[model samples]
Target chain A: MAEGLVIVGGSYAALHMAQGARENGYGEAIRLISDEPWLPYQRPPLSKGFLAGKIERDALALKGEAFYRDNGIEVLLETRVSAIDRQARTVTTAAGANLRYDGLGLALGARPRLLKIAGADLDGVFYLRSLADTLALRERLARPLSIVVIGGGFIGLEVAASLATLGHRVSVVEALERLMARVLPPVLSDFMAQMHRGRGVEVRLSAGVQEIKGDGAGRVASVLCSDGSELAADIVVAGIGVVPETGLAAAAGLACRDGILVDDAARTADPAIVAAGDCVRYPSAFTPDPCRLESVQNASDQGRAAGAALAGKPQAYRAVPWFWSDQYECKLQMAGLSPGHDRLALRGAMAGGRFSLFYFRAGRLVAVDTVNRPGEHLLGRKLLAAGASLTPEQAADESFDLKALLAA
Target chain B: MVIYQLKDGSERRVDVPAGHSVMLGAVQNDLPGIDAECGGCCACGTCHVYVDPAHYGRLPAVEAMEDDLLSGVAAGRQATSRLSCQITMTPALDGLVVRMPERQG
Candidate 1:
């Protein structure tokens, strides 16, 4: 009997799993099923280069089509998996094709949370998530027009920055008092607010969108605020956040919370099935509680772990998590989670726009956020992965060679 | 076209349109060695590459961010080290040669 491997979703995790499985000597037939028609492409550029018209659609592809064919990896594009028969170890496709597999990997990513407000379905209202959304947004950005970006997260801010760079009048309305409140400290948030404002972006914080009002022509005309204010907008982009795609997994009787529940090995409740990427909530040393990460680093690392396990390697997932966001001239790099950090030490002049914030919890270095400081970001990931100990004073001292701490 | 010399001694010459970064060129071609985990934002040092010394001086001066990132290259930094993502391809850089570092941090 010939055993086979079936992978769901077409994203970074799925590609990494296939690569990892091959590297681990999994010579069996590997089939990847994706609902999207295109090959697995990188998503980070969609918010930056793709939106800016600097990168073509073909440039976003992670691997050339020939690579998959040469590797003997079968990719069933535009095909959706309808059901998983755990008892029969088979998966039914949307076209009613039953595919048998010895192991299943779920890289089901996430979808952007849509604005459920009135006039959200208006013609000019948009959400940035898929290639289709980006292509649509790019076309809309062709002519100069007033743009209102809802939400202050990375996607919203990046879109605002790109639009402003392209000479469009941009305004950002954030519901929270500070921008990026969920991930960044108040200080960084304030700095970002100032930066955005300096770039000719009208930033309105602590303001919620009451509703997106449309003109009689079914086009977005203005955004009404909770504070009884309205801002005229030709285009309205909503980027509140994303929710993991877990409906399919839950239907198959897999353990799921906000995301599909998985162990460190990327294995779900059923050993025959494993999951990775944005859709899985897995245990991590970086966080006190199990959490779901929506970053390229998380997807690739977790997928590698799942693939290795599926190949019988069975190693635990322990890769240090890292993330980056580019807005205008600033490049912010973050390493590890800093949820419970009680103290923060600044390593450089914040006014200079080149500094690293060392986050410490109980006098131990836990995480770092670097603004245009890549050396510190890299060393920070290394130190956190190595579990190195450094006091706030040592971190604050510019004379100290942070790289030396990696050896300790 | 920009030429990239891999650590394994293989060379790849990719057609990179102007305004696109050298990292994007390698990435679009699916060339090995450049991880570019941060997607050419100059945040991740995964796209570290050594410019062929002959063409190093002809390239634009290294920016502060690229210099900072080069310091973190896992393969060890050299005077020619540059984050390929930061170097935009131009007509003058027609024969530009970049060598991939042994490893990218």
Candidate 2:
């Protein structure tokens, strides 16, 4: 009931908004409301380290309990805000409690896009998103079983890699012709497919899930593909994609298009309202089009921007976007967005499993994808942030001193 | 507990559990200096800190990822400079002191 800043959701963006606001000298009661039972935690490791049991649950927490208490951040975990009244400047919780806020931040995040095929609702079919979902999936994976992972995006591939590493019979069914076709270039997609195949995972490209056949006891037994092929599967995990949680924002009459529209400062059309994280589509310095990014970098930076705006010192959120994925022995690190890059220049050998792909659009460095090349990836981020240009020839030459350009 | 020596010569002592990293100690306690932007993934070198020379030798060797990342840190690297996330606290190093860098990227 504190009449100050009220942030909705429990994730990176929400936590950062609270922290950023407090750090920016927002001396008021800040309340973070979330439907999740646990405090905000990192989602990146859920499919990799957490599923592989390399990372403990405690380590997944974004910040410790003492953080919220000491920072005067009132956390309302397991509480969902059902409605937002912009007129009254109050949020109505699912429990019928209305909390007033001088400013509101919507970090609604996103939800898994469930399969709409036949028998999709059967047991033994899961989606990985929250801690509860991961725990349930992990529990079901106690024994070795045939797992059919639908989709080949980051989540699906990470899950596929984890399950395959765990010695399970795994198959990746992708509707597209290549793995991670949307985000990765054709070459990297081929590399990913080859990598998965090398790790004993059956990579099924251009195979769409037609139906998930269920056992007589209501558990999934097999997955029927669009090619009329059937894969014997004891478990089905679909990571098709996610739909932004923009219903509340839209209902409250906020501008929304696939995601809630926000400015570079993470502020919505309404000056008193702000949005960040996966649920927001905002302007970016890297791209001409306003985009919505799902990486920890985007979430944290946008969250910080939202907090700064909430604290009355609004600055543009233009941090270079970067993402990382650890699969088996390969660490794929990508910096910048390469949506419309016309050319890709490779630096290093793919055979050696260490390389960097520089994506250029209209003769300008657009993005960089580096595999097992942490140094290149970090340099790419800096290069993009500085708006430094690199020629394809220079990028291809291994001996070219990339660090010298930072000084330029 | 872990002591974070701020760039301003101030010190922040926080009670971070043994299993957590030194970066977690500063972040969880709301210490201002360390950004830890990548959230301990060692992908971003923002959590760069200078370990006290006295306790620097006691810590484990820096891994390749951390080493590679340290090269890109904003404050520049030093012999005693280490990524706080790479340094997990232990009972043997209860009095470990890590000095925050001038800034993080």
Candidate 3:
């Protein structure tokens, strides 16, 4: 049995691999390391239910104490793996703890990128990523505060929705022309913008943050934008984007592109070393060239794949990517990876709220954004798994049931 | 074979196979109301069913996570509320009538 070190920033990938290793009879030491003080919890709900007071801190826990103890895995919290010495198969944590392992997994994940400005270092400036970040932001929710989210991506809009629901004035500024621009098309983005604005959230697109101004007390007071706008704010949250955690991997002589380069098996330059979750830029099942995914499905699926391979069940990871986000009254579910597409097949009705837009590349269905359409999303998941492509005309027709389309 | 009455007054009969989880039986036959989000791993706590008071000892011991997820539900959980995923269907479960809770957190 090989001892494994799953260096992780969060819990999802770490927990899954730990359990996988245990189930596969790897009785050796299975240790999980993270910078956070708490055990792993589901992060998808952090921006919605968890922030809205619907979910408590205990409810956010990934697994209870017994789950870890029963499986014979040791969890080390608030420990950051600063350096990785691949030749020695050892890792040095931030606190100077050198731990050796027979096999290693880099589920290090990514962090929210913050805007560099004067107010960025000031008080009341935030980024909603970890449970701690949510708890800190939740404390400000009850203070009758005004918020300015620096980006209109999923993170920003979700924060705006949560704040507005808590009866706070929220403004979202995005450098893109519309909201969710990275994942959705212009029309769908506009629809989401309308949805957010209708809920009384101030949504400003094409408005990049030039400088964040602070008050005399070192608190965020206002935001100065490229569009000649200055909005007053008691708090500022930077949800601009995220960069993959690849520094330790790079230092350890692992092949680093934009992310840790790996094959479909999620094996890096050293086959004994593997990377999963948001850190590894492994090959996509549908598209060409390797890519790094920051989504939960990518993390869990890749972790399971890598775990199985490490346990002598060697197989290439070829799973379709899927993710969902809950904002206000809508549950947006997307199946298949939503990028590298050429044409669109708009299904159902977007403005009415229940609709789906299919993203196709060279007449092959690559992705589908299903808003309140769980059936379409499920069918899309199956099709993408089978590499089954549907035509734009077939998907656009409301009479053609998604189930029938799948059978075709 | 077991017959259970739904909250809406509809009746659904399912074959409670031996050694299979009751939630697995309901899901395989599309009896509805059992949404096992974590795939019967007791992680998501979606397959919550309130067992009849008379049928408590018929199931296995309750695990920690299965008990924790039940605390978050809306309904008044009695001695029952077994995570259907955790219950392995046995010959003892024949003619068992466990009510499905209307909501899952």
Instruction: Give the best candidate by DockQ.
Output: 1
| CA lDDT of every candidate | 0.90, 0.91, 0.76
Q: Per-residue alpha-carbon lDDT of model 3 for B1-105, expressed as tens digits?
A: 656556686878877667656776675554557655444544445677888778777667876445654654445456777778777767767888788778653
True contacts kept of each: 0.78, 0.53, 0.00
Scoring only chain A, what TM-score does candidate 1 earn? Answer: 0.98
Q: Residue A53, candidate 3: how far off, in angstroms?
A: 0.8
Q: Positional deviation of A221 in candidate 2, in angstroms? A: 1.0
Predictions' DockQ, in order: 0.69, 0.58, 0.06
**Candidate 2 per-residue C-alpha lDDT over B52-94 given as tens digits, one digit per residue, 9 for 90 to 100:** 9998998999987778778888899999999998888888878
Error of 2 at B39 (Å): 2.4
Per-residue lDDT, model 1, residue A340, is: 86
Candidate 2 lDDT, A1-408, residue by residue in tens: 348999998999999999889879999999999999999988988899899887788888887788888889999989989999999999999999999999999999999998999999999999999999999899988889999999999999999999999999999999999988878999999999999999999999988789999888999999999889999999999999999999999999999999999999999989999999999999888878889898788889899999999999998998999999889888899999988899999999999998999999999999999998877898999899888989999999999999999997
Docking quality tier of candidate 2?
Answer: medium
Off by over 4 Å in 3: A1-7, A405-408, B1-105
Candidate 2 has a TM-score of: 0.96
Q: Point out where model 1 deviates above 4 Å.
A: A1-3, B10-20
How does model 2 score on DockQ? 0.58
What TM-score would each prediction reach against the true structure?
A: 0.96, 0.96, 0.81
